[model samples]
Target chain A: MNDARRHHDMGGLEAGAIDRGEHDKAPWEKRVDALMVLLGQRKILCVDELRRGIEELGADAYERYGYYERWMASMTNILLEKKIIEVGELGARMAEIESGRREALR
Target chain B: MSRHEHTGGPAHAHGHDGYDADPTHRHPPRPDLEDTPLAYHQVMQMAVVSLLVEKGVVSADDMRAQIERMDALTPARGARLVARAWVDGGFRERLLADSKAAAAELGIDLGPIPILVMENTPETHNLVVCTLCSCYPRFLLGLPPDWYKSRSYRSRAVREPRRVLAEFGTDLDPDSRIRVHDSTADMRYMILPMRPAGTEGMSEEALARLVTRDSLIGVAVPRAG
Candidate 1:
């Protein structure tokens, strides 16, 4: 895809440029930087694994992650093994929390 | 020829994906992508890895010598703060009042976006999304999941969270309410999951274990049993 198409496909760069007061950086790129930092910190597992987590994840981490399946799973597995996640448990709690959030919105 | 499994599930013959259609079993890598050099990216990666190691947050010798290819795997700094909140009510109050200060207390400095921590009370459920995309607080949490940024999740989460939750394998009862928050502007969130019952006086590590990454993200609940 061309730069314009790529930019559009990722998410609008126009909004990013306006928001940052500079050239727009794609959302996926920012996520990549965050993952690198996490790897550096030894807080997570491997780089590829982090990318996988980004793919499988359904919620925002620092900012957001674009669809990159293989990479996200790798990250999820490593983080899961590292005890950085509570896995099946956290999902259940988030549902309960959302209930209250819905009321506030109404 | 069509491959068939004894269990009755449709299957593929020969090198057709794995038994379960898992990619890990089939066509592992494309040669072209594998042959490409990543020297420059690796160098940049090393700089980040070194920074974290120097800080002593992660040991240098414990894991691999070099930081391999990276991705946003787990929830970032935000989860840590939520864990802290689970133990210390006073700190939790401070966090909800001023996320930046609370984060600083834990040595996490979130620049620009003055982080604001939100508590998920019994009456309100908070789900964050960047309607345009996914905007999370990585300063507290580590990274977001892949599904978070998908077109379906981003679009549906704000308008129809109950539906989204069900899709994510969280089936809530009809009587239970659901709320979703779109994370926009400078404000970012780290969910304060309700303290689980039991373990009235567990140690910090034990409690931290219960405070899973998903709970802080407002997706899952703490494990009580």
Candidate 2:
């Protein structure tokens, strides 16, 4: 056994009973899943790259974020790391959408 | 017959239609972001998608098509494969040898990822778990269930499988051995459960009805019609 196993690598450990409950995926989550596949198809980001990004998320974020949320975090980092999208560009886009949403609400 | 040839919808449609009585528990309510603000990652996703489309990295139509393709894939594809394997010995061999290739022969694109089909016999049962992250056979089975990605399932499935199976209401014979396959980075796994008895002489489509998603995951054996 590796002495320093990553937090996401939780194979054999004591845990609570399984939650058998299921939920229909939200539209946003589906979009996340689709974008992931699409990114792979475009050779922009590979599964391994996304996976490595996720593996590096420390124990705190790994447990806190939802599954697709973690994926979103990973892909966002990968895109930025590859210089596909810059930090300012991502921030500006997000702000534009947020203000647009707010305007629609008003 | 192509096993699942005639279908406007699945022969055995599952209920999560909000009408199903889940007396025990229900998924947490999703906040109406209209009244509130979207989560950070939700905003990030929107921004990313917009940027991608604007950059011409991928078109909006490509996203729609990919999402539709993913949703269209369910356990039915796996069910169809199991039915074909049951009726055709050669297919069974090919399926066991290389599931992605076998699926491709049936026009199912399992992407480029390699998937291994584990066959369940009289004396053996197989279970799959991705202890790291949920590396499911997403192309074949669609998105994995939430429980599969849960910390409890990931931690316990590799060590206490039979007990977990019991939680899923599956109790195999004590004599039969259980083999747990931890899905790694490269390969994914799906189980080929043994056919239920007295289902002889049935059409492939009819046989496919007996093969449920849980059966494909080796959680429960199918019931004969």
Highest-scoring model, lDDT: 2
The estimated TM-scores of all candidates read: 0.50, 0.87
Tens-digit per-residue lDDT, B79-160, candidate 2: 9999999999999999999888888899988777788899999999999999988888877888898888889989999999
Give the TM-score of candidate 1 (chain A).
Answer: 0.38
* Model 1 lDDT per residue over B139-189, tens place: 556455545555555555656666665554555657656666667555776
Q: Pick the candidate with the highest TM-score.
A: 2
All models: lDDT?
0.51, 0.83
Extract clashing residue pairs from model 2.
none
lDDT (Cα, 0-100) at B166 in candidate 1? 59
Angstrom error of the Cα, residue B164, model 2: value is 0.7
Off by over 4 Å in 2: A1-3, B1-36
What DockQ number belongs to candidate 2? 0.54
